[model samples]
Target chain A: MNKHKQVVLDRNKVLSQIQRLAEVAKTDNWQYEYDAQLDELVYGKDFMPRDSFLFNVNGEINLFISPDSSVSGIHIEYFQANYLAHNQELQPALRAITKKTIKNQRDNEAATALEIELSADAFKSLFSKDQLITVL
Target chain B: MPEQEHILKCRDCEGKLVIFHRHNYDIHKKKHPELEDTAFFPDRVRNALKYPTFTIPGNGNSVTCYYVEEFSINGIIKYTKVVLMNKPYIMANEKIHHIMTAHKVGHVQEEKYPGLKKQMYHNGNKI
Candidate 1:
């Protein structure tokens, strides 16, 4: 009997394994919600943050910073009419992402009340290089 | 559970303030239950509002008030105890001032509101 067995890689199994890895990587994508009633756009990490306090950023935006000084979330009041309208370049992409997030939340029966998450690609495309630096 | 409320005499507006049982009963509890060691009791909150270090106006006549006590060494502020009124509630109502929630925060830059300090003086000390 041969002491060592020859290992064969199943091509389909390998492809599926790679796809699973890609999905796992998307889990860290940022989540957002445009609350119509509040007229605010809340963008942040998906989980409930440990006790955070609001730090007003230029009166319009509020950054929720944790005790550790990490920025947990961002809340932009009067989002569409004020914030987005003023920044015309950010409007199209933001609106599209918001719509898609809402639709996804409505479709997923198991989705919690937390803000809907953006897909990996959508999250990456949401902000330009400068915008990302400024916002963060 | 029986309803418990705290009737506070707001020093800011010099009016009656009410903290309903439901407002600070659960997560933002007045007294910490056996579950946790943290507490945001009413008395401390009321005291902070009465002698606030700084206040900033919010949208729609609301105010974000803070009662900060600083500890300095050699003219350098090393630590600060910050009691923040988290919600932008109606704090100016002479008839009845209803403040919503209050929480403690970490060190905050006093230079954030430069002009507001002129209006925020307590015990002859410029806040």
Candidate 2:
């Protein structure tokens, strides 16, 4: 006869990972910004806590997962020159937003969302990596 | 008591470095308990700014990222500190160069952003 030890799993950790995946999948009402100075793009929902661990998805892209087990945010460094500058459609749209054409902050946010919608292929290229490598 | 304004200055740019109680101090304490020791906290930050191992451009125009490597029982750990040229949260008319936050990035981050590795500098010399 063999005695087996009972195995217990961390429920909260599992739940948070699930929630982060769901949020990433949905991709709705995401607040985004393209910092022209740093040429970085960051977008996410909810507050990103201090305990968030960064998971590198690809060379220039990474995801932030909060301690609560939720996807806090994602950022793409060198957004303009690397990703958007080459593309004809995305280049102009992003330039317009950063150029301060949309004076209102709220309206600017809306414009950014619209630009992202138009450049789905461009943005998707950043997340083309299907495998999530644990860099942390 | 000395005001926060008189406490520190940015090593590279020579600008004043301000740490807010709410955004920086409290938040950092909660997130990075490893750096909670009051004795070495200020010295660590000051030295990090003075002699950073890596200096990456920040995510925003007004921000700058600094990384310093530390040796611990676990091994070489890197701490990242971000400073902003303008504190948007503050309602003050004057621009404030604020120390936003500091946290450990571990060794893995160096592997993740290879481009940043190429730009690493030690004591103002490229390593």
Candidate 3:
């Protein structure tokens, strides 16, 4: 075979090997942010224990927590609300009320403000993978 | 003790982010009837607040929760962005979320190296 033809064949063979390896790896993922992190910067710690009450879907409290409800060394009872509400269907308002409880705290103000700013940003987050839905 | 301030991290040099993990920090509490009894983790993010010149959906909705953290593991650093969304729950499209995550990581990278995002915006990721 001609030297030029031989070189072309070798290049083709190398390319074929690369293609096979690519299929084996099969991890072509676009880079984005991770999800576990939101809490790190926002809450600035792992989930802690706190005082909380479980409210109902109709906006009524299933049971009220004591005035001094926080228990030390717990996940900080942050908010015992619904995670599925963001999915759809009118949430009992418990989540909103619970969230309201945390809104604008002196310590959280900085984190909340940052989150609010990012929310308005033109760029998207890596963890916004979950499907978004509006409730009636 | 808990968190410091906010800064950026780079995805290229470092890696991905850890995200939303609230650990050791100064704690503050609230006990208002309206606000209820809630706790604060301080400026937990301490390092992810740059990327100024921001904007939200003109459609009229506010964000409730979000945070991104970049750290190293096994000599590889990664970026993570946690979002606890509320209103306007339904996003415009699917790929849009991925774009946003990439953008947030972009924010982390910009935070690490000043002017990176703006430079990328202008130069278009030549690297």
Candidate 4:
């Protein structure tokens, strides 16, 4: 019979892994911020906890790591810019122009926003295999 | 002084209840004075239970409970396990619950607890 043993992680080891991830994020255009009082490490571009990223039009992803080395959650928000006609007559004028033209114009003028939360496992998987190996 | 204890019951199942013992901070502070002001203190577990960010789904009303235990580990004073028992008398997901028990030895192995459901969320939201 084989006996299975659980692997307990060292506190320092866990922190090191999180720091390594943050370092990698820096090269990926993510800024790193640490709160000593909350013991939370956050990395992302214009990221805020539980709030939508309003500053940048680029995709925003926020990763939160708690003091215990557990990942709280990852918040991802994608933003796309769209152009709207300032003149009220533009719609009617475009309709008279061509049906195909309206379709193309609508497609170009559509904005998109997506917000999602990734599970802990999914968040960890985002890290490179090399980074994960040391922590494991 | 006797340690404080709290009894939590499943809102759906009135007869089902679990007893959770509060941590003895005095004893723990003596053992690990360095963690006196940190969240690592055993009392933090109690505080987490009192002010949980989320709860487990139960039949009708939601249920809240803590499954605390103590272990002998280096540089650690105590280990507290908080379990949110839901409807059908199910326990919280092991993977998520283990977050609180990380870096410490568990006095009771998880396998010892049976017939507990996992991944049931209350209020349809999660922290």
- The runs of at least 3 residues in candidate 1 whose Cα sits more than 4 Å from the true structure, single-residue gaps closed, are A1-42, A45-47, A51-71, A75-101, A104-136, B1-13, B18-44, B62-94, B104-118, B123-127
Write one digit per residue (lDDT tens) for candidate 2, span B31-102. 344345554466766766666777665543355566676543323233545444443333244344566555
Measured by lDDT, the strongest candidate is 2
Q: Is the docking of candidate 2 incorrect, acceptable, medium or high quality?
A: incorrect
lDDT of 1 by residue, B1-127 (tens): 2334644344442223434334433533221121122333455555556555555443222334445443333332211122223342453442334444344432343333354442464752444
Cα RMSD (angstroms) for every candidate in the order listed: 14.3, 9.3, 22.4, 20.3
Model 1: per-residue Cα lDDT at residue A38: 35
lDDT of 3 by residue, B22-98 (tens): 12112112211211222212222222222212212211122221223333333332233222222322223311111
**What ranking of all candidate models by TM-score puts the best one first?**
2, 1, 4, 3
Q: Which candidate do you rate higher for DockQ, 1 or 2?
A: 2
Q: Candidate 1 or 2, higher lDDT? A: 2
Chain B TM-score by candidate, in order shown: 0.47, 0.57, 0.20, 0.26
Q: CA shift at A41, candidate 3, in angstroms?
A: 16
Chain A in model 2: its TM-score?
A: 0.50
Q: Which residue runs does candidate 2 get wrong by more than 4 Å?
A: A1-29, A67-69, A86-88, A92-136, B1-45, B56-65, B70-127
Ten-residue stretch with the least lDDT total in model 4 chain A? A110-119
lDDT by residue (tens digit), candidate 3, A1-136: 3211100112232223223322312232111111222211111112222433211111111111222321111111112122222323323223332343435454345333333332222013212223211110
2 against 3, candidate with superior DockQ: 2
Residue-wise C-alpha lDDT for candidate 1, range A1-136, written one tens digit per residue: 4232222223333223223422432453545656553345656555435544443434455545443444445555556656556655555545554565546544332222122222222223322222211111
A best-first ranking of the candidates according to their lDDT comes to 2, 1, 4, 3
User: After superposition, which runs of candidate 3 have C-alpha atoms over 4 Å from their true positions?
Assistant: A1-90, A93-136, B1-46, B50-127
